[model samples]
Target chain A: MAHFTKATSVHDWLDQRLAIDTLRRVLAKEYWIPKNINFLWAMGMVLAFTFGILLVSGIFLLMYYQPNVNLAFDSVNYTIMREVEFGWLWRHVHAVAASVVFLIIYIHMLTGIYYGSYKKGREMIWISGMLLFVAFSAEAFSGYMLPWGQMSYWAGMVITNLFSLGSLEFNGLVEWIRGDYVPGQAFLDRFFMLHVLLIPLAILALIGLHFGALRIPHVNNQDGEEIDFEEEAAKYKAGRKRESKVIAFANDFLSKDMFVVSIFLLFFFYLVFWHYGFAMDPINFDPADGLKTPPHIYPEWYFLWSYEILRPFPKDPGLIAFGFAQVIFFLLPFLDKSPNAVPASRRGIFFWWFWALVIDMIVLTAMGKLPPQGIYSTIGLVAAVAFIGLWIALPFITKMEKKV
Target chain B: MKELKILAIVVFFTLVTYWLVEPFAHSQMHKHVESEGFTYKDLPALTKKGDAARGQELVMGAGACVGCHSIEAAGMPAAMDPVTNSASYGVNPPDLSNVGALYDAKFLAALIKNPAHALKVEHKFTPESGKMHPMPGFYGAGGDIDQEVADMVAYLQSIAPKVDEITPAQAFETACGRCHAVRYEKWTQIGEKPSFKKKRDELVFETKLEDYKANLTNYMGKLPPDLSMYIRSRGEHYLSTFMENPQNLLPGTAMPRVGVNAEGAEKVIEYLEDAGDPKRAERDSVGVKVMIYLLVFAAAAYLWKKEIWKDLH
Candidate 1:
């Protein structure tokens, strides 16, 4: 308490940089935004907002959620299906929000990547966004096993086994995460805490940092111009007076973003209300039966790509060689020599970014949908190779030669 | 040059993260065939082989067994040791002081997998092990048992128990102590019965037909079934996994969540998966080998992509 001494005048004696006023000022509507940023920009906020909804809905579910493996399934069913009146709604909202968050975040990521959002001063924002994605996945994995369903149990089993593959005396890894082998009461309870508490806390902290990094100055247009802030502020104030418009969240930006939000909300709402939320598969309702493996168990769609990758690897086949040969995306920062980033033409290059994005999403989606091995695995190999050669390396070379 | 260094550093870190997290490589590098849809990475063979000696230290000492079990130490007071995190989770762990000579690895695996399944198989236990605790089926019970199970199993095989090196009569006395305390008292009254050991044998073998069938009526019986051949037939670590969730074998059984740790289940299953079935065992090794190879290939590929950054260009 003593450390938080009274502020010295308008400034603090301490070095706490962002007071509420400063935060508000930084986010002021009058701040110059990129003129050409279209509906695609809405996705970043949509990702953040949906995540916020997920956090709220998740908390409600957590209040009644139990992690006792024996009771985990029953407890989930009682609340979502029986006990709480709007429990189903809360549960469905959480489920749908999860899907929505992923959709928005993935598209947001593609937007940032293609447009060089990771370039220049914006690298930290991209990094934070990636971190948000990883944390969100952690949150999802923890929660997926909370219901103690067959898929949850089997999924946990399959993923956990990946740790011990080819020795490395990796059983300890499972114990470290699960606090034991197999997903049990102890494992589920800890996972529940991580899903509901720890990851969310980490995500909020990272989100704060993410937006902070986003507040860094943005580069403008194909010529790499800077926004003249003082001139823009003067123009904004004059226009405010001429129109006699007082900007309130409701009166100005909300009115516009509201229409966009309503459109997205309508689709989301239609899906939730009309179709039943994504289901806990029938087989999963029964507890995990180890001796009796399920006939066909697949991971959730989001993990399909990675799961596909794991389908064919031999246990002792040199892991580093195979894994490295295939999953090159994890090391992208090294492969390209876009020494000068901050894409000079955010508007004109939209076509290149668009096609690149389309190719990626299509292939990634196809790889995910297909069975993991044989022809499909071969296809994945080919496509991944093609992605590197065509979309990344070739473009980089072309762009570099042009500059030279 | 400065930019290149930064790129190099980024490459190094990305490789490190990828190597640490070989997300897809665990299964994709080989022609792995799982009869079941799921597969395991046949984990790398132990480079530092566990000394059966050090394994002993792990079981009773720092491994913190008593920390999550109903395990009793040699000088345990009459009161129950507070339940372990496992037992609080509802597992009824077997006492370990003299267990070494009593049960083989396979039988022990069942006990280790989940006490409920062990009781169901070894004792044909009808009643629930105890009231439900937070415990649920563990390691062998589900899809996610990992390598730590093998370590714990290795550790379990190294432990001494509450009873070992016993004559059949002594075995009867020790095992039936929980069920026939008064009968045991009467038999030891020193005058009428031939001898306590003799009487115990008679109680075991003599109570054959009517009592054997009738024991089914009330779940608790005077004797646990012979476990000698039980482990023999169950296959490596099969006992443990099956024991973790015995309803897999005997549906509608009364075992409530008894194994707490997936490792506990795996520990038991490694023993069971090994010690039990030898028929077609050598045959399955090929498939297991294939699985191992695939995983290794994936890991290597992942590492290569992560580290070298390009094909030796």
Candidate 2:
């Protein structure tokens, strides 16, 4: 790697004065990345870029959003939409970006599963990613309440009340989470703090750790092959780490990442500009009324799969199983004990099994969107069984597929 | 250089989008009549202040709040003919037990001045005779009714319990006792026992003993609906907006506007919530402690992870 800046002398002086060269080496230059990775690998950077947009747009929204129960909805409708310059655009971006970020993350996770990126040393990275997913879910939920619309209030009530399904202890825990027996100003105030400050800071720290963990083992490729770190270390001179045929992250991959970001932004901005309310509930435009509830109370689409998972069984067991479903993804590395980390392309049996889970997820999502009645209940039950069944059967399936 | 070019294109597109969508975004401001008038920032501070006693007086007397609204605390009578009123006004006015907790004080004052003014132009009084709100503006222009409206709002607030302090029994009594009898024993205890002749007259209204029943001369001659499980039947927020202007929320029914100010509406809402679920305040308080615990737990987990993985690099 070479320094392209014309202020080379100044940079060299700074390097000598502060020992800043090593920082540049580790963060900017010497780290090697696989040359064969494709567009799917770019999602991490895309997510980071999108997160930056959300932060910027969210700041603009926070400027006008009043977390008080009486003023919240009106603040959005009047101050943000009418009074502030370009405030409407920023609010729409903040909202629509939440849904889009979830979409990107879902695809990224799907890619990881297909390429077996969660295997072995990368398990912590996968786990961190899962934790981030949970944090993101919380962030989205808390942020949804800032508007204090009809949907916001009812959805907050419905989702928070889910915890009461547990025993006496669980009911106590639910009360603790809600801050009140019902979703009131207290709940709104607490959620506002979380959405604006606390959870976002945690997410930022988790993101830093996620990338740090990734740098340790380098990146995984779609081919599901390992680059032997010990052998590479041995090949290098005593003090220097071995380097591979690599792409410069700042020059090459950053360009690719930015290009994808620009294309994604085109669509994102289109939604913000033309179809701003595409992902929002119409009832949300109205101020929250404790006495009037929307006809249907459901979460945003990202949560529909998990919400469906809770539909099949009795209340407590269903909620526990729903939680386990999220936890089960973190245990994937241990569950797939086969020695080989094979991509779906080469592993025919695992490929079918994986798609089956995908299909089950889709079916469950559909069932979740419908009222749990008659045939929908039966369908939801079947999909829920298959979802859990796939996890239980993973190790055996992996072992059985050794011949492939 | 290529990255810079792509960045430039993205910036250009964003600017274009901002320009193109300005009209649509700005148009949204004028879309809802509720969005019209002064925001909280523009409101005079006095609108938020009121004397509950004075407000109560206005509600019962000059404001005519008692005519349409049935308030347990004030002991306001039910409408003469809820069925006929429902037919004329579009829907039956709801009781006012939790009105203070539901809306902003400024909104209450604005709505009281002109009932149709609370909604968008499309939703306001239509030329069709039955589509308009029965509520007449109580203040403005020739007379400065600010203090009166404020007092009425204060009285509404006085009736509602604190959000955290409401009990299910209190909620049921305040919000539902007027129309619905929850427990037979409780009903018998609360209801005034009519004399023998009066009971017979009441029976005649139900049984239609003769062609000309005394209550028949009343509007539509319909009894108020039972509220035994209204806590369960009506969704949250229904009564809040409904009480503001029944015609605006649900058109083509006989429910006249109840004229309970915003503070009063909030009290009614609190009562409704308390009736449905008594444990709300407790739940919210416990939630804060749970959040603090989770934050500490998260921090501890992060530190433990750092300790375990320190050598991995």
Candidate 3:
């Protein structure tokens, strides 16, 4: 309304009635973004692209996938792979997209944390991102069961059984989740609904909230100081010759984001084609056997950190700790209430603690893949302790640190 | 210029994604070609109905089932040369009273055809090591072998306990209680030897159950494993495959093959599943209803989120 464009005949009829031009300018064209953001920030767009690929490919896969316990694995491996046109491509794309989504999101989250993107007004944004992560995990887990392979069956059994450690009553909850004493047809059917329909809808809604929350404030920059978008807008209007600190969302940042996403696509497609089954466990090729249990029962790489947190404790307590580890990230924005919002490179002393936690996570991930015995168990305990300790120490340490 | 670059990137991304389809199709074809398993879906279906009575006769007579294994329902007493059998085979043959409840028909047929093949035994079993492969292929290209196997499997099914509401005691009896007596001391006085009565109609009377329990050690060369917890010790899958042919799971084992059909083997599996986890059915039924509740909750939550976020957007 403020800067109305002259009605061009092609879009004029729609533009006057629907304010299409205004919507475009507000949503895409003139939207303000910090100019200083590096390629690390591009991971957010990369994750969005990955989600798009998953949703489209998943829809294709859903057409052929049989949710029944008896036919699920065969449908994916035999019928869909051989009978359906381009079905193998869709399945691989969905599977490969899942791993890539996690990869991008992890980098995105670390970048957010390293740059203090969760500070002050961005609390809701950070929390919603964490919730998205939780939903994505649930989505991934439910999707994994669609194949009804040996690993999926046993993993479902092991994970659901974790809920039984509380009491006799809690054991009922475990059975309810599993739909049987173990994973079976009922479990597969329920998970199918969750994977294809329910969780994806929830994820879409959360992504909307994530973007909405992001729009309220100027994008956080490498310098950590928030840019004044109002001043930039005023300067642009006054015809100042100086270059704007804020970049236009449409042609500038969008192009850069898409360019990075394209580069990421090259890698993602490479993994899908050349190394299609790299992240997949070969044992999962076999159909679900309630009788034959695979010796090693480790989770996918992304979940290894949280899984490692449980190894040191006994069953009931270990499960409790694992649950806490997942929920603990939500409390991070409040815990580290640092007045300074400077990037990690400039944030003296705190950078070491941050990197230590990062390194600790890497170690925990490795330990998670290893059998929970001997030196690995010891390392799991030590790392878990250190992981929690960093959060506890964060608020106190940040408050005491000198301003940049 | 920027728009053209973006278009070029988009085109490149699309090309890269589709490029791998050919390779993916190749691997998928490879998977189909190489796949091999003794799954129930892959086995040939039986045209004729199995005869339990005929099966009983073949199991006791031609099958020579009683030479090694014991079935509680048949009152079949333990093998005569327990020591010699154990010395030659390494362990005593497992009792087949619950074999019906432990394995399915396909596994049983595969085992009866070739014990070594059924067990997935990788060891080179030759004619010289005939002693090592204790359970010979009974259906070795013989005419009427299929019918004989079907009858024997039916007979095993008849003797083996049917899968029902398996109480702890019944579960123990079927899966482990036969071999591993729960409390041997409670059943008999110290120094009292158990006895068995052989009769015309009964090999061992149903009344002298305690007597059979007392003589278990004499019949079994080595102490049998405690059955009270065998279901827990060996998982359901391992038990199914192992029951098909113990030699495959454990090489040089004295456990002789118990010839059963696929249905008989499945009955045993059902019994074991029931024995270890009796509440599976009840739990599964409740799960569907809970999911329905979750669906409603998810719908309500979606509406609520829409209402809350409407103004913000």
lDDT of 1 by residue, B121-217 (tens): 4233335654432223344323223333344455654554333233334332323222221221232211113444677676754443234324322
Which candidate gets the maximum lDDT versus the true structure? 3
TM-score of chain B of 2: 0.41
Candidate 3, residue B306: the lDDT equals 46
State the local distance difference test value for candidate 1.
Answer: 0.49
Instruction: Please say which candidate is ahead in DockQ: 1 or 2.
Output: 2
lDDT sort, best first: 3, 2, 1
Tens digits of lDDT, candidate 3, B133-238: 5566775324487887877777776777764533334443433344453222221211112453546324333323334444554434444543222343354555
Docking class of 3: incorrect
Model 1: per-residue lDDT, tens digit, A44-99?
65676688778788888878877787677656654454556566567666777776
List candidate 2 segments past 4 Å from native: A1-19, A228-245, B1-313
Candidate 3 lDDT score at position B207: 29
Off by over 4 Å in 3: A1-10, A165-169, A237-242, B1-313
* Residue-by-residue lDDT tens digits, candidate 2, B79-149: 54444444444334545665564445665676666656543332435676355455666753333488778
RMSD (Cα, Å) for all candidates, in order, is 23.2, 18.8, 17.3
